[model samples]
Target: MDIYINKIHYPINNLGAGTRLGIWFQGCPIRCSGCVNRDTWEAGEEYRLDYEEFIRALLSFENLDSADGVTITGGEPFAQPRALLELAGFLRKRIKGDILVYSGYAYDELKKKYPDILKSIDVLISEPFIESAGDRLLWRGSDNQKIRLLSKKASAVYGRGIDRAEWKGRRMQFSIVGDSLYMIGIPGRGDMEKLYEVMKKRGIDFEHA
Candidate 1:
């Protein structure tokens, strides 16, 4: 099996509960409006890799074992349902950490269409990013999104939570992939503009950011 990917980033603290291995799958049918990750909207073979090779590449990172979990975001992970499940199987069987996913699919629809995949992961952040609803929740993009627990560990971390970030502590991180700079995180409103301004001061032109 092959996984079409946008990028894989690690030790990211803002996307999930802790430092995580972040995998951004390529292609999104959901295409929620005003999404900052427009770069990931198309399915491309540019970053395609054999599933086994991808697994090996991740394990090659020396610090991976220290990560709290693996976070799978997209490009709508379920858009490539088979590949997503295959990779999820591999990760769940081989790794010792939790597995998390973000999808634009409604929770009930996900259960109907991808129950097995849902059962494999520890956390799920679901529903499309509704730009108008304007959410400030932990690990969610919009007020309409749902953060669910598929494993005991998830409940332990997120139980009794409200739809607001602990401190409006929205954050993002930058990394280099194949000579291109990519960002990872859930940014708040206007945060990208501020980030662009900061990048400008450093001589990095990110006006589209």
Candidate 2:
């Protein structure tokens, strides 16, 4: 099997429960309006990764031991159900941490089509980002979105909600990968615009990915 990816990062602290591996899959059909990750909407051969090779790389990742879990996001991880399940199953067998996923599909939609994927994941943050709803709480852009702790592991780690206003759940983390700069984490309403202005001041066009 093979997979497509937008980017991958490690020690991501805000996307899920703790320091974790974040894999941003390539291609999303939801295309939520005002999405900050327009860069991930297109699926190109440039983003392809062999499933076996990807697992090898992950197993050998330098921070694998320290990572609290693995998060699959971007381009809607469920878009590639077969590959996603394979990846998740491999990780649970070879690594020692829970698995999380984000998807533009609602929980009911996902449950109907990809029950196996749900079983493979410990937590799921579901629904397309609702720009009008704002990123105020639950690490969601809209009130319609809900975070489901699908497994006992997730319940143990994130069963209780963290105080939203002061918590790091709504924050973004930046990293430089190869020649491109990447940002991970949820973006509040109008946050992308502010980021664009800041980057523009530095002569950066600010590619939205």
What does candidate 1's lDDT look like per residue over 114-193, in tens digits? 99999888888888898888666777767788777788877776564633445365676888867678877777777778
How would you encode candidate 2's per-residue C-alpha lDDT over 1-209 as one tens digit per residue?
A: 78998877888888776789889999998999888888898889999989888877777789877789988898888888899999888877765677888899988988999998899888888888887774566556666677788888888887656324333446778898788878777777777788789889999885455
Candidate 2 stretches with Cα past 4 Å from truth are 160-169, 202-209
Give every collision pair in model 1.
none
Q: What TM-score does each of the candidates earn?
A: 0.89, 0.91
Candidate 1 TM-score, C-alpha based: 0.89
Q: Supply the global lDDT for candidate 2.
A: 0.81
Alpha carbon deviation, residue 19, candidate 1 (Å)? 1.2
Considering only N, C-alpha and C atoms within 3 Å, which residue pairs clash in candidate 2? Answer: none
